[model samples]
Target chain A: MPNINTLWRTYQNLIISAAILLFCAIGFITAVFPAVEKIQSLLSDTQQLTDDTKALTAKLTVLNALDESSLRQQLSAVISAVPTDKSLPTVFSTIEGLAAQSGVSVVSVDIEGDTALATASAAKQTPEEKMLGTRTIPFSATIEGTLDAIQHFIALAPQVRRLLRIRTFAITFPSDAKPVRISLEMDAFYQPSPTSLGKTGAAIVTLSDAEQSVISKVSQLPQVSGADMSLPPPLMGQMKPNPFAP
Target chain B: MSTSEINLLKRSGNTLRTLTDLEDKLRVIAWWSLVALLAAGIILGTAFFYLSSRSDQLQSQSAQLGRQIDAQLVKEGILTSLKQRADVAKNALDAARPWGNLFPILSMIALPTQLKSISIDESAHVRLTMILGSVDDAVTVVTNMIALSGQHTIRAPQLISFVIKADGTVQMGVSFIPTL
Candidate 1:
């Protein structure tokens, strides 16, 4: 029913429509699909980041608590190491007992200074030995005795069930002093204080949520009460920390 | 009509025919739209799967954070009993200590074994295969029954009834109720 030119034009128009539709389909698959995929991945990443933040925060709380515990332990260790002489009277009496055993008359046994101990902390450097510190308290003693008596006294010092060590000793007799009477000056160090026993050390900072949660759980744990940890020759409730280094 | 006019008319006629031919094929647009819809559904489903999985992970992480925060509160003395230091006396009995198991095991060993039983079920019901050997043994067993519960070491048959067996063995089955 159509002329030859009309028929040709009709074919041309149909081809153009097909070409346009095909292009549109290709564009939707290649360009639009990829873009959508990229957006999905970014959204996934955002969710992951949020999760990471929450987890890290919780972890941080646990770490902080552990850190605080460690610090507290350190403080306790330091307090225990501080030298003290609260048991001086007991030590003197023990010395008297030893002197009686040795047949030595102790004319004088006086503390060189006002010495007192707040705690006794012990740290083992090895299974059998410790690097002991009694510097917080220093003492000087004078005794009148013979060579054998002095030796017995020295031996008796360590044997006192609770340790007392002789750090330094000197034997002196003036030019006009009696030959039978020997004068001795000795320095002894006794057990240190456990000052850190009741102390809380510096706290560590935590910024994570997980750390916070763990700390919270630990806080709820039940603990035994009514156990007294006070040491004899008790320290007046006040603990003055060492002055800050200038 | 003039020669040019005839040519124009022919051209218009051809264009109309072509458009008419394409109209039949254009019906396929509905089919393509269906395919597009299916593709969108699949895309949406995949996205939902990924999002749900991510949400789960985030939830777990949040819970962990909450736990950590709880720990912090404990250390800060927000929890009272936990902050209290264990004393030397009770430290020995604390379940946290490895040596605390000694007392419980000792107590178990001290449990009395007066009731005799042939079998015990997982639910702790006793079945007696043999009865009491003597009237005195029966009374003694009953009196001591208070100490029989919670004793896992007693594996022997218990008394169910006072019936005497053909072989002269006494048989009886008894249950423990005082929860000794």
Candidate 2:
């Protein structure tokens, strides 16, 4: 057996080579691996940021191109058709206006379901209505006139700005010489304003061709109701930090 | 005391030379590996920092544009509302019964007999009461409705009631679904 000095002399080069390899492995594990991992993470984050920037740019471009006045005008027409709330006064006014135009005399108007505005939440949906996902105010009206006037009124009901769908109508002709009495059951549609806007990252969708045509059609509808439906400006004010204290 | 140790066996000349060559090669390989690892670390560090700064710039730009959009939040709300309501209005217009078409048909049907009373609904179902002067008029009414049904103008004609009055006038009540 060799002594320690002899063994060390023989294995010195091999030991130095092994030590270098160990040093490289340690450096790779401690420094290189973490750096590589961080690079990969940063790359992913940068890619996400690039995507967000593109979306925001596109959205800004579209918004800049939009004509606020035109949007407001088109929106006004559409809102007149399907109001955001139950504008009962407009509904009655439209009916009366139609009656006057058709040369018919309005007899009575009755609202169906719960008439109290406070109980709006209690309005129940039928199975069929639930499928349509529509909210409606159902009402019935009676008018008396000549046969021609009655027919004219029926034809004009759905063509006005205050949109009404006639569910059923009955015309009664008296035996003697008298005017015809027409009773109509109808529905007026409304929807509540959206509670929240889309997220900032969401794509802004423009009006589709079909929607454009709808706006065009409604624009041609006679503004019989003439209800003011301008959306109020957003209320902006800061609240006190301690309302109770105040 | 002896300071040096002695080798126990003599090494073969060829084997010792070969071992010396291999050891040299291993030393070269180790040094090069270290250099390559260091270069890789520097390159990765540069790329990481560059990407981090780029990410920050893009994030800042996005936030700026987001603020611009937020400033027009009211317009956004109006646009959204219009989109929603326009869709509803389109559906309503499509689903509305065309009373214009029905009135012309009604006029045609009433041309033969006196249209006393009529009822119509959104589903195109129509109930009508009319006065006929004679039995011939009644036959004419039935045949006319059947012909209209054949032409896809109406469907499933039903005679609900037939009453003969003392004045020799016949009153007829009928129901059918119009194809409008």
Top lDDT prediction, candidate number: 2
Candidate 1 chain B weakest lDDT stretch, 10 residues: B88-97
Q: Candidate 1, after superposition: displacement of residue B20 in Å?
A: 22
Best by TM-score: 2
Candidate 2 chain A has its poorest 10 consecutive residues by lDDT at A232-241
* Candidate 1 docking DockQ: 0.02
- lDDT (10s digit) by residue, model 2, range A61-172: 8878888889989988888888877888888999998998989999999989666875345667666455545567889999999888888898899999888888898888
The clash count of every prediction, one per candidate, is: 64, 0
Candidate 1 lDDT over A166-225, as tens digits, reads 433444322343422323333333333333331122233333454333333333322112
> Each candidate's interface RMSD, rounded to one decimal?
18.9, 2.1
Residue A99 deviation, candidate 1, in Å? 1.8
Worst 10 residues of 1 chain A by lDDT: A221-230
lDDT of 2 by residue, B1-180 (tens): 333456344789998999899899989989998898889888987898789889889988999999998777777777887888888888677666867567677765665238888898666789989998877777888888888888989888899999888877779999998877
lDDT tens string, model 1, B86-161? 1111121121112112223223322212223222232333333324456565565555444443354233324445
Query: Which fraction of the native contacts appears in each prediction?
Result: 0.03, 0.62
Candidate 2, CAPRI quality class derived from DockQ: medium
lDDT, each prediction? 0.43, 0.82
